[model samples]
Target: MRGIYVFSDLSLHERLQKALAELNLQQPTEVQQQAIPKALDGRDLLISAETGSGKTAAYLLPSLHRFLATDAPKSGTRGLVLLPTRELARQVFKQFKQLSAFTHLQAGLITGGDDFKYQRSIFRKNPELIIATPGRMLEHIKRNSCDLSDLEVLVLDEADRMLDLGFAEDVLAIAENCRAERQTLLLSATLKTKGLMQVVDRVLRDPEELILSGARDQHGNICQQIVLADDRTHKERLLYRLLEKEQYNKVIVFTNTKAQAERLGGAIRYRRHRAGVLQGDMTQDERNKVMDWMRRGNINILVATDVAARGLDISGVDLVINFDMARSGDEHVHRVGRTGRAGESGLAVSLISASEWNLMASIERYLRLQFERRVVPGLEGKYKGPAKLKSSGKAAGIGKRTKGRGDKRRGESEAGAKKPKQRLRDQKSIGKRRKPSGNKPAGDQAGSGALGDGLAPFTKRR
Candidate 1:
């Protein structure tokens, strides 16, 4: 078959090409164009590509081709894909199954929150491709239920997220169990973190470095906007209004907390929209069902926490509403990335309050672009924040502290000034007590107080 693109030439296996065609993938993505050929050449790869950039397939197709080309026994795992979350592992496994459809290569998923014995049963099948989370995979390794002795390729999908989730030790442990000569492919949304670099140094050898532009730049197709909300209630109203007014094929509302995700999902469902909740608190089976509902259009809206929705590939998500501003700029990027996938245009609206304005500004600075400020006509918020920003365009009230020496000295003087008034009141009380009463003499009073104390001592002893 002729190549679809200049880069997707004879380097890829014919079966892989047929699978790509069946998936309607006519051309290689930028990351795939750059990384796949080198990966096929048996080079250790460190790829940094934005979400929804076909990074999964970039690594998967090459690994599948290598497995199909080799005569090595499929008795032990040969290709290992380690992700940070169970959802990501399952999604990658699904992708692997799709790409390997024309070949006999088997892929198995092992993650926590699932039956270990059932996974071990899958392991007995001698799958060549293994998709798993670091923690669960490490458990299997320690239990002697899974073996990586014959592992040829180790793919760390979302290495940065794994490190964020504190899976560094687990990932390194799994890598240690794999053969030293294994080809390590590390893929991340960003590779600037020290932890990811350390993993790269430990696993990859003279790796081919491919760093694509960040998600913010790549997601220009997403129309970003900011809605000013006075408070949580106002944000909720704005969210409901947006959902009611705007037309979207499918929408994802992102919240910072699982509680908030559940609340918002419930609220949306109560409003008569088919909405589903995806958060860390949900069981693996429940999460899978929610994802299935979202994918199959049973639910038109999905409210999800950041960690739960990371690396999820749901297509045709037309709009993303950040119900709560993301904790960081990177998080904001990933939250919005759930939409505008695969060259489709999408919309992202972040509901920002007075407290979240600074966060929104930081994300704007990180992305090097300003979000268009929007308002609901009748439902305009009272907290519009600073009328004018600093020269850097960040929110004006932030990064300014009132803890200088002058303020400290002022506070000290105020506290010190109050002491004199207290001392004066004490002096007045002493003077009043010293003033002689009509019925008693000063010496008599002292003698009487002393006598009363002596009597009290005797009474207490009794």
Candidate 2:
């Protein structure tokens, strides 16, 4: 399947083949070869493949072929692709347009930050396909602006990331609105993605489960490494050195927070590197511009957060630096997958400080891979690594985590500060302030006359 089947062998529409030729895509990837056949057969598919695999094309090609071959009227969106982020939706939309270049099938893009009226107009035109995020699509559905009754195919790309973004209910609502008779395809990077099976149970019907590549499957072409940094400043210096010394055409540095990404991007630019920042805070247009600049090689360095970079694929990104370690193995997989794409060689170096050592180790254990420890010649940190390690590669705690140890070191300790009394016993006067009724009428007892020490009757909510 790897090399035996090309796009021609899959019996795609001739025009589509022409477009593929123009894109120089002759041979089908493993995921594409396996999925295109089953998808063409109109089977519900649950595909678990590695990131940067040809999953997008695997689903898109079969869908476009079905649309192009059939002479049915385009009543509404015949195919719908639901992605986790606006970046992904844009990427898929770009690819769809490229593949359908030779045909008349139209695709609409819907996401959080676009014009609602324009999207409604897109629906009015009844395009053959719509690429959208779950949240915005649900908004359109609520407005009766989204048409799915004529939908023939449904795809959930990055299913796990959607669940992480808390789109489970929105997706279910959208699925409920779609015709159950339509074909469904769900793709995720990991099989053990939390709440992924629950979504599968409800959306897919007797689906053909395809595990072309699992999350644990290491990227053979990526050399993963770890650099110990004392702090963010240290990490920044290390990044500058990497950009100076490494042999990479393009590099991306991932941070955990949007603010960190912006700050890092600024620092990199201050070092005279053409860097760009991508995060949720930016408007869709800004983010799109940054991505455009990246693709055209106007900017070679991209500083981004995990959510913003989801499903992003750019060629020549040979180096990935985790300015901050990914919080989970699934995140780390996607972060590293940005490089070493399409069987190309890559280098992914994660900067791990003492606080992130265990998290990095946990990710290593989860992925069943070890990151090589590297050090800068003059910028090495004092905290080299752990003194003891668990069999799973996590840092072994000596005994107990000293209370306030971290806060103390960071000048945030509460030690020596007077403990403000917060217990009820510390305010016993609350009960003593009330007077006894002494068998008086209820109204009279609650009056001011019943107060002890002539205090007002605990009125005005104390």
Candidate 3:
């Protein structure tokens, strides 16, 4: 409770302070400290902060405060939250419920994979706060089951992810229906993408831009490492050995594809470890069951794809294993962010094969740090890879094609040598060419040149 006074100093409602106290949340996170005040002032916001930075609470508290302080009736969903995934929507809904426990504000969740009838029934009541995914929310809007005319605040959570999932049009359509003067907030891990900016221009109005520490700066508590493997088999062996050796409370192994998640989950279970699989293709119930098992310690290992695991707020994750290298640096940051949350010490290990070395290097360059390379005893990889590294620390041979001084000089020499030969051939060809005869008509000559006979130009002799 040492820093509990800091939140009160922000002029938050007493009820919210009580709720925060009950949750044992003392100090406001950096994102909360900066975002909450401006959001409370009813200003449009565009925030770029790291994952696991309490961004949910940053926007939730202010919106809840505004609702609780107002004397207006619970009209058509005063507060609306749009997320990229159902899991994230569920997570945000849970948090909203917890924070608004002492208030009269009712928050309803609208996402896919649930009973449509049940969701429609909830929408009929028109809860003051609504958390939903873009696709399902758009569907409800189209069916006339949802209303946004009275919405006072609209929050787009994980805005970049929404654009990445191709929900930009749906989100924009939903925004278009909201009150023109409604307060809009766009929160994301990165704001550099063009798609996000397009949505921002469409929705937010003169928003106050807040840029906080990014993912690279938030890796203080995570120990990152990379292990080279010869191939998939070697990677599996390495992963199996790590699971057997490392003492972790909970671990999430990330793969690039759903099939890989299933295969890895099965392999981990075969080794007698409690493991579960999560992917985008799974129904909401199935995904919830897997997440519940992991939370309750029934599953110590969860194999997941990036889409299924994004914005998931699970606690007690001590290790994150990249069973397959992430396709992008941002995805790598998000996968490893599952661990090292809430100031807990964690480990992130990447199993890199020779083919993925360049990818691993790019991730390192993106993070601006080199991961410690580890080798397991008696299981060393045969593919040592290139011994040299480029100045950027990437694998030496994988650099972009750049001409060196010698290469430039040789190219110039080759161009000069070929020019004289080309000119000589051109001159000889010019000497051998027959000139057009001035005696023939222009059209006839043109026709004779193509058809080898001037008579082909006309049907009869002219």
Candidate 4:
């Protein structure tokens, strides 16, 4: 009720109230209400929710409130938030700065790209809040440039993704350095595997567990469609055709790799379309410019990798085209979720190749829904390529076709009759029945001596 603005008539901190009121944030998102209270109470939290559900504000508000509630002390690193990527750390730092504008909270950002000497100089000032990447933070700790002895709160944003990127060991090492009494908050879009739980135990106390349900479905307002692209050629053809015709004010194309993003951006630009690329390989200034162009509608088509796509708050992005399907089903959900946000109707188009059939299927399964498949009219053609799973092996009720020479044996009994009727049994017994395992002639094998070699010599002709 403290955070809920819709049903309950409750007030918040002056700054949060003013910002929420100004932004027309009429009510607390489910994640905020469920997690903020405990977070404010100084309990460790494990939260599993979807992106764009106001999860950032949920934790930020409570952390800021706790900072303000206490007496103002000399600034020191009291809170540390570890994000998976530099981009995400930057984005989260931005949000924290915006929300804490009224409060004199000094938040510093530590990531890989910036100058280390500059960062070390800022550390001398003792920032109260430090938002950083695991690798960079570890560097500071090793250099004895930063101290975690007074650190009270540790938040791991995008924990699942950090694990996916092979940062589990780094995360554990960082966790070991934090204060033993720290209130650890683990937040992720989706949580899987007990290994994640094991990490939780290593850092957190009994801690409060909050799983918000109302945030599960992000694509509710987005129209999703699957285009059947049997191969890469077909996929490209369909993508080209759609871009030529689809009416969208702004578009974001997602690719699996940085190189793919660059290539796709090049092709779109070669066609005279305003396009740009955003990936991790780009320098900070270059990435900022691309993001600015995208945000300003100066670039109508922006091709980006998943890192740039996560925690993205782009508005008016009316279309999202997945040029290269996501490697994981979870990533697929997050990719299309870029559009159709904030209750705005948008379109998501996936150019799925045969090799990606199972990836698409797994996505469908995760969303617990089926998508309508359509083919571009002029590009329909039979494609010959390597076999791909029709869907993930778990696609329900859609049986795979029998392959090799195993098809014939499926319905036949050991006797080789289509059906095991009594008449067939009597006939089989009278003449010949193939012995389960013997190389003798058919007549001798079935115990019928009259029919000499009975079709055995002819059967052996092959």
Candidate 5:
């Protein structure tokens, strides 16, 4: 019933209502229903929702609502949103502009890889809301180009991701600099991350916890499948085949390394398809060009690293191919979630090599789901599913333990394998001690090169 709630029926001001009308945002998502009312109540909130769950609107609507209020003259930026990546920061800034389309309020973008002088000018303009990444925002804070003393509301988007990028201290320090009376909203897709809760405890003040969707439930509609491959060439063939065969308006292929993304980009381009590569090493201008191409449908395929996986909300990404599957289940969820978004059907396919089969199983176990085994007609790989499975249903890794290590270890452990190592010379009996030839007196043996301790006589090494 809550999912059926519409945006116009909610308490949003007419300005926002009109903007929502233009954005075609009529029905409130599950997250929006639960988060907006609490956010409007000026309550600090801790939310755990999937990516592309309308969580951005949930918080942005409330923050915009605050800006639309006619209560007090704005002192500084009344609202601040901190994200992990520049792309996500830009995405949120775009949405902020779209949502405030009907209002006179302004939102500024503060991120790295842009002209610092221009950002300082943006600070001088004193936008009502500032969307920034922690590092560059901290830089502005250090320069006094940015101030949060009069901040009214603060939102930390993808908080866990910020922590993962080693920004724990930076985020904490930024939160510390915000106005003490600010309403803080901390949102993260994966809540079980190590330092995420610590951040929640430190930043949010008695926040109401909002868990709208579990990680397992996030990608339920997306069809997940695994294609077995032998090696890199095999994978490339399979990928090229999929690109030709799969019917998709747009597709993103995720790889673990920038090098792989580059390689795949070239490979796809050679197949006569327009492809773009998005990674961390590229200049922001290059990245912007790629994303612009992506948005304009100039590029049908985009190869990217995990940098794009976290908080990006790209539309028409009907298919996701794991050229390289993610290292963790949380990351897999984010990758797959890029598709099948906003109640649209999508597909995610991962190419499993001999090396990646075990990782695939681990992710399956972690997510508590199974992947459909798919074989391409001419490009099927040698690496099918594993021959053995653990009692927990994960593929048994071909580890030392599985390779007769258990029995060998049992034999060794029974034979006192834990004992300290002994050199062969020390282990062998060279002869009896002979008591240092005490038959000869000590004084007589001293000149004979016997040890002063009288344990053994020195012999020349052959």
Candidate 6:
């Protein structure tokens, strides 16, 4: 009976069943059916599933069952769910509280953009569930507040996004404080990186792995399109033209940086469109208010960065506009995945400039779907010259501007981009040495005849 997944045969408490029925949840989703059983059985899990695949319920249902099934004599904090952004933490907290409305369970969200005093008071209640972001949670930990030793389940929702936001170290630090035998569940939209794999290895013990395919590449209901923009100005014009089509309602416009997000939001607002900016630099209160406005339909357009936009479960968003090319192909997927949520029909439009051509190609290749590339009626021109792609992780040929160390002003340094190598005591103690070069090594002629590796040459290794 252990580790077996059977939603049909599974029994839930009458109260929970009633709550589910009230919410119109008649049947378990494919992911829920498969994941809930193992989670309920107190097994660590690593799930690579798609966005909007009902992952929240998959983990929440089992967590609820565990809470209600076991006695909670003292609930200082029974479950800890770490998400990458404040929006996701709020969303998860809301969902869990919704399901636990008729039960004795209590849940709290610990995130930035809120009052710490209020959060402390909420945490003092010893909630059955605590949903948080790693950065804010770590702050709480450092203050000698919020005990996690009593945590029974530790869920890292959107695990890949957490790493992208540079929360890996904070996540590990917090996780180390949690009980060693606790049921740890890692849920991600994708997990191909070695860092993510290493995290899974460290956190999960004999985990039951589940890879729900098909959800990754095919969001059947969403129609994706790529539009060609001659330049930044042309892209803006095309965006305005698209918004003029009344059919596109509740649209979200994504940008790669905070400055662009603010500018776009300002332009839209100036045009009498209900628009707002959502970025990490905004205070928690400001971000919350903006999200509330969007949810309340007071704002028609949300211009945001990846940090602000990811993990948002806002309903009725019918259009997603990528103003700038996404840095990674996976990020492209996450951006489009926002609109086509909860089984809704949606449209995703990408504006690709000549420089972003390579990024566009990579996205198409990843999805295995070639979009029809077309230009707006008024905007048509050939690229004047080949624009050098930036040398960062961003694919070359996506833009004409290359931001390199050479581009920096006289006083500025490229320190932020250059990460120092992390030294590990164990690896050093192992005394492993890289094989020395037998000779002067292969020349450019022997390789590809031109600095030959496909990737840009890095600074010479010390």
Clashing pairs in 1: none
lDDT of 4 by residue, 356-441 (tens): 66677777777777766666788875743224334444324455776755755764555475764567556664666676654557
Please name the candidate that would achieve the greatest lDDT relative to the true structure: 2
lDDT of 1 by residue, 18-130 (tens): 88888887778888888888988899988888898889988898888888887677358898999999888889988887888898888999999999999999889998988
lDDT of 2 by residue, 26-65 (tens): 8888899899999999999999988888899999999999
Model 2 worst lDDT run, 10 consecutive residues: 448-457
In order, the Cα lDDT scores of the candidates are 0.85, 0.89, 0.87, 0.77, 0.88, 0.81
On TM-score, who's better, 4 or 5?
5
Candidate 6, clashing residue pairs?
Answer: 113-284, 355-397, 355-398, 355-399, 356-398
Residue 317 accuracy (lDDT) in model 4: 84
| 1-462: candidate 3 lDDT, tens digit per residue | 123437778898999999988998878988898899899899999999888888999999999999888857747789999999988888898898789888878988899998888999998887898999988888988999978889999999989888878998999999998999799999998876558888898899999999886656766889999898999999999999999999999999999888988998998999999999999889989988998898898988999999755799889999999989998887888888898887778999999888898888888888888899898888998888668888776677655767697798898997776543445656664446687766766755566543456344434547
- Tens-place lDDT per residue, model 5, 13-47, is 99999999998878898889999999999999999
The better candidate by TM-score, 1 or 6, is 1
Residue pairs that clash (backbone atoms under 3 angstroms), model 5: none
lDDT of 6 by residue, 276-332 (tens): 999879987898899999999999799999885567888888999999988877888
In candidate 3, the residue pairs with backbone N, CA or C atoms under 3 Å apart (3 or more residues apart, or in different chains) clash, namely none
Which structure is stronger by lDDT: 2 or 4?
2
Give the better candidate number (1 or 5) by lDDT. Answer: 5
What would the TM-score be for candidate 4 when compared with the true structure? Answer: 0.79
Q: Compute the lDDT of residue 168 as modeled in candidate 1.
A: 95
| Model 4 error, position 85 (Å) | 1.3
TM-score of 5: 0.85
| Best-first order by TM-score | 1, 5, 2, 3, 6, 4
Give the Cα-based TM-score of candidate 6 against the true structure.
Answer: 0.79
